[model samples]
Target: MFFRFACLLLSMLLFSGVSRAEDPVREAQAVIANQLSAFASDDAETAYSFASPNIRSIYRSETQFLDMVRKNYPPVYKLGNYAFGRSKLVGGGELVLQEVLISGEEGQDWTAVYEMRLMDDGSYKVNGVRMKRNTTSEGI
Candidate 1:
């Protein structure tokens, strides 16, 4: 029947559209991994390539960004180990929030939360990073 054929066509179109939706979390993870690898190898240019346009605009050049990272986020530059914890899509998939744990040579441990934006190119990149120091209270 024509009705049956039309219904099947519609179902297929809907499924295809849903499947085309981008997975922001996965994209963000890949970007983060690329950046981390660059940092580990001291490849500033490669690491800067992973930065979002907004970040690149703020820093102007890869060298400047590298200097800022080395001067400000020393621990991240010296990071020895890291683990990606949890990632969630928020605001109806417009934003991705992820948490990462990092350890450095000085026995320093840090937890960082990243807010990523879904770019028009179907990729995700970090827009902001909020770091927290992991510590315990010295109680009496």
Candidate 2:
């Protein structure tokens, strides 16, 4: 049993390291997905932790940040499903712009463009999001 536990621990450590080595686009998308999951459970602190320093500076507190998201971004705050759309690196690879096509809880389609900035600690954080109502019949 001890040998089996050792092997499992090693595998977990290796997998965790490999996950962080993913490309910038995937990394940014992962951060966004994590934040959305946090919102689904109303985990304000976890959701706010994914925000960039600039955003955190403005919001100041987790409650305030979560409140803003709930008020201004209903689709993201309560999503049914989401798919990754277009993605590109900007600012000389320091930033990733990713488009997420979301189906809201109320069945409305929306597009959320997220700007993710690479922080000094080598993690990407959500800098901002620009959301627009999908006027077309396209589905994600």
Candidate 3:
């Protein structure tokens, strides 16, 4: 009976750690999804809230950030549909590399790779994204 209890306790501990380890990836995905939803709704402030401190500093205001996205990342600003692709964790979970396959409202295909960082307060924020047009038949 003691051995069985010990084994059960050990399993519980191991499973709990596994869940904690997976939380960062799930949180990162949620942040990205929320930001995209905010963009879809034209909620500039909500979208900007997901950006890292570095990005916020550079853009200065939510409107400025939205304007930059509109002018430079048209596909992201006017997204039709998006699907998550590969993901990687780096620097002991301090950073996440997430690939997103995006279809623009105007039928253009693009690949957006996002870099998200863990903030000081234990929240994940999008540090940057690199958007590129899909040139090959394989698609993003």
Q: What is the TM-score of each candidate against the true structure?
A: 0.76, 0.81, 0.81
lDDT for 16 in candidate 2 is 89
- Backbone clashes in model 1, listed as residue pairs: none
- Summarize candidate 2's per-residue lDDT along 19-71 as a digit string, tens digits: 77557888899999999999999999999999999999999999999999999
TM-score of model number 3: 0.81
Q: Lowest summed-lDDT stretch of 10 residues in model 2? A: 131-140
Select the stronger candidate by TM-score from 1 and 2. 2
lDDT by residue (1-140, candidate 3, tens digit) is 99999999999999988787667878898899999999999999999999999999999999999999999888888988888877888877899988888987667888888899998887899999988797322322
lDDT of 1 by residue, 1-140 (tens): 99999999999998976765556666687888788788878898898887788898899888898888888776677787888878878876778887777886678887777778887876677677777777322211
Q: Total clashes, candidate 1? A: 0
Each prediction's Cα RMSD?
A: 5.5, 5.1, 4.2
TM-score of decoy 2: 0.81
Candidate 2: misplaced stretches above 4 Å?
A: 1-22, 135-140
